[model samples]
Target chain A: MARTILTALVSAAVMGVGSYAASAATLDDVKAKGFVQCGVNTGLAGFAAPNASGDWSGFDVDYCKAIAAAVFGDATKVKYTPLSAKERFPALQSGEVDVLARNTTWSINRDTALGFNFRPVNYYDGQGFMVRKELDVKSALELSGAAVCVQTGTTTELNLADYFKANNLQYNPVVFEKLEEVNAAYDAGRCDVYTTDQSGLYSLRLTLSKPDDHIVLPEIISKEPLAPAVRQGDDQWFDIVSWVHYALVQAEEFGVTQANVEEMKKSANPDVQRFLGVEADSKIGTDLGLTNEWAVNIVKAVGNYGEVFDRNIGAGSPLKIERGLNALWNKGGLQYAPPVR
Target chain B: MAIGVTNVPERSKSSGSIINDPQVRGIFYQAITIIILAALIYWIVDNTVDNLRRANIASGYDFLRSRAGFDVGQSLISFTSDSTYGRALLVGFINTLLVAITGIITATIIGFLVGIGRLSHNWIIAKLSLAYVEVFRNIPPLLVIFFWYSGVLSILPQARDALALPFDIFLSNRGVAFPRPVAGEGAEYTLLAFIIAIAASVFFTRYARQRQLATGERLPVLWTVLGLIIGLPLITFLVTGAPIGFDVPVAGKFNLTGGSVVGPEFMSLFLALSFYTAAFIAEIVRAGIRGVSKGQTEAAHALGIRPSLTTRLVVVPQAMRIIIPPLTSQYLNLTKNSSLAVAIGYADLVAVGGTILNQTGQSIEVVSIWLIVYLSLSLATSLFMNWYNARMALVER
Candidate 1:
């Protein structure tokens, strides 16, 4: 009797697998809802943290705002769903959020097996370690026999393990579920080392009680090309999101800013004219199922990618991160965009 | 008078109309109910599976064989990041069992002490126990865990300036590091002697009981049993050469090196679960003792039994019949509450499973495994407690 019931239950569960699976009209859904649902980090200083007034503004938040502007022509036509490291993927998978701009790393396992579509890396980060200056540990190699604090369920945790194992070093891991907990634990002296992306280290350091007391180690253990992700199987949505990133990069390369985007529309440069939809019969935005003014709206809403970075995490911000690999392709960086034509 | 009746009415007889028959109606309604319930369950499962598949989320237990690629804070068995997810989960399971078992033992001891103290004639003792119970019971277990973790343990001094205690132990914010025992050659003989001593003590206990039954005189059974167990192991260790040594922790720049250390995560979770569960267990213990008849204690006193002996030998035995069932519940509660280890990153089953689920995106598979493991743990605890309860139950002639 028990075996029969179990078999029946299993069969019934399998039968339910694809009953409500097909949902490719994310754009339409967003249109109907009148806002883009964006998943972001619960609280990270420069990438995606809310201010005291609960208004989120950061490098990642700009991507979310750009998407909303592309879709609805208004940056504020969006809602933020702050997620933990463990909750990000499920939130995206379950359609609880339209897109995740959560400083999430793009990896093959996540891109393929996890059914996520990641493109156009927004932030090129690498895993690094931070230790108190008093420890006199100038190099990651000296991190052997140290207790490292990290957040659980992140690529950083996996990379830390692989790095230590490859180096044949012994270390203890003190993992927490939330980023804030990791920060607090490390600050409380529960661990000798803190490991995460280098950018995150710099960003989080400012929030530390003694930010100047700690220094990031020089070892870049893993490539963490953090990007915005949407659900897979929606090529239209994928194109829209990936191209939104490209448009921002192209705008930056074309010397557009939030203050000057409208003025640049009258420029005689054919490429700039076509990009800002100044040229008649330009199908760039329409091809992606958006208005011809989509790029203009995006640039107007959040400026270009460099502007977003500078305003949130670069010289204009307290993070003061040097845009080393994040600079434009011609400027010895990796941010390149395909021609709009 | 009833036996004189020529015919007796059938208890389950029906009238001419089948709808009027209660038995038939009951069967008919039950069949419909069963069918409805089965259909509802089938619909729910089918819809959920369909939704998951449509969402492109893979659901299966096959990911267990993959590399965990993550390190746990504490493990009783040998484990590393290279270990498979299955092994990581096993380590987590063992950690859960470790905390639950230790928490249960400590809770019971504290619970019994406090329960008796609550009834103490001394007002100070009674008030203290009451205060302890009320304070713990009123707060949530998660808050208690945070209190110990962030409020207490995190405030400890750093590793480089660790507080050194007696016997080469070190206390720091990282955790308590102590000397770990490493067995040397010939240690097997000492272990063998310990096992043999246990077997001998069992026989000695039987002999003493039988001797008392026959001679109506008691032997010094406690002292003899203790001697057999302790002396045999001590003598064998000296004869075979003391084969156990301590690997004491030495203070280092980063942390204490070369010894066993219990992380603060496990310590906080265990401490929180124990204190929280002990409150409920104390109340159960007090109620059990109170449930025991007053006559039993008075009768023991009349038999010239001392007050302490009367409480232990008479009142307590009867009280246990009332205590064991609820005590089992408290044990199960503590075990389940150990899942809160995730909040503090104690690497218990739920925390480890959560990491795997996130890594693999196998939410359904991981959730099912948790349900099965927790259900099994609860059932096993219930089985053992039921057996113990049976032993303590009254054996009426």
Candidate 2:
């Protein structure tokens, strides 16, 4: 009798899986809500952290603001919900957030099985190891039989295991669920090494008890293409976010920064005129269902791509991270955008 | 009697009369309750199905076979990132059982001592036990965990400059490292003797109780059992040429080389849980003891029984009736409280499950597993405790 009831329950549950999945009109929802609900990291120094007055300002935070600027013409039309690494995907899946701009790596499972669309990469990074200076370990190969501290629920954990196995090295991982716990464990000498993204290493080092004592080893283990993601099946909303990202990179290539945007808009170059919406029929913005001056709004709110980078995490900030691969294509870097036409 | 009696005819019952009958009303209410309960269950199942469907999340146990692809800090069983998600959870389950069993043992011992101390005649002893109980019980368990984890353990000296203990034991912020025993050849004979000693002790207890009942002569059962259990094991070791030695830890460039090191994660979790739960157990003990009447002790004294004998013969056995029920709940609470191991990065069941839940996006499956594991653990504990209570209950002739 009990077996019959359980069978009936399983059939009912499977029926639910067979039904039509809910899909919301994200653009209309955002318009009705009057603000873009953006998901961000809980607290990562150079990526996303709130200041004294509780206003979030960082590299990822800037992308969220840029999208808000493109959509509503006012960058402040965004509500930041700080989510942990595990919570980010679920929040987006449930439509709790319209856009997830957290420093999440773009992966195949996330894009396909999780049913989300990732825009272009915002920051390119790779996994690396950091050891205390006194250990005299100059490279990743030296970390043999070491206990490495890493945060769980991240690509970093997977990469660490793969790197060790590939090199035929033995190491124990002291895994923590939260980023802060991992940092504390490493600082307390519970582990011989700390491993994560080199970008994250640079940011996390400053918060350590003795920052100068640790140095990141030179090893780019895996590609971590951090990008913004949106729920699938919303073409108009996806196009808007994707084009906004392209416009920022193009603005950087055209050298149209926030301070000189107005002067650049009046230039004789047709490429610049079309991009800044000054030309008679600059319809690139309208194609994505955004205003003709959408790029102008993005630049005005959070400057161009280079300006935003410098303001939040580049040499202008405390992190002082160099623009290695983040520089423009003409300057021997990977960041490039297609023509506005 | 015959003169006062009058004959009367019985009245016929109508069909409508059954509606007002008490038994009929009871049946009506019971039927209504069962129907309502069934409907409620059906409604919940429907809502869950609709939600999962709408969210586009696959719901099944099939996800358990997928690669876990994540590392746990500690595992009692062997594990790797390439292991199945099911294996990862099993490793976590074993770790949970390990900590809960150890914590339960340690907590009960400390709790009994403190409970007895609270009633001591010495002013300082009573005050100290009372303060310990009040302070630990009043504060949140999580706070105590953090106080040990981040505040005390993290502040210890580096692994290179470990505080050396006797027998090549080392203490540092990383962990506590001590010599691990290696069983040489013929150690199995000693192990076999140990088991034999345990079995003999059990039979001896039963025999001693029977002798006391039949002959009215008490055997020295405690000393005899202790001697048999320890003496057999010791003699076996000596006869086998003492084939057991320690693999002592040696100081290294960065860490201890040979010792078995218990990580700070497990240490903090075990200590916090033991101290926090011990406080509540102590209170339960005090209440159980106080529940025994003073008149019982005096009655024993009237029989010329010594004070210690009076407590053993008259007070404790009866006090156990009050202590057992609450003490069982305290054990269950400690097991549930072990879930806070996640906060301190202890690789207990819930923490490991949480990591898998995030990695696979299988929140529903993971939550269902947690519910099942905790439910089973609590149920099994309650069953054991109930059996014990039955054996200890007062009997009437």
lDDT of each: 0.88, 0.83
Q: What TM value does chain B of candidate 2 have?
A: 0.91
Number of residue pairs clashing in candidate 1, backbone atoms closer than 3 angstroms, sequence gap of 3 or more or interchain: 8
Judged by TM-score, which candidate is best?
Answer: 1
Q: Each candidate's TM vs. the true structure?
A: 0.95, 0.92
**Residue B304 alpha-carbon offset, candidate 2, angstroms:** 2.1
* Per-residue lDDT of candidate 1, residues A29-94 (tens digit): 888889999999999988899998989989989999999999989999989988888877766776
Model 1 global lDDT (CA atoms, 0 to 1):
0.88
Pairs clashing within candidate 2? none
Tens-digit lDDT track of model 2 for B264-306? 8788889989999999999999999999999998889999999
Candidate that would win on lDDT: 1
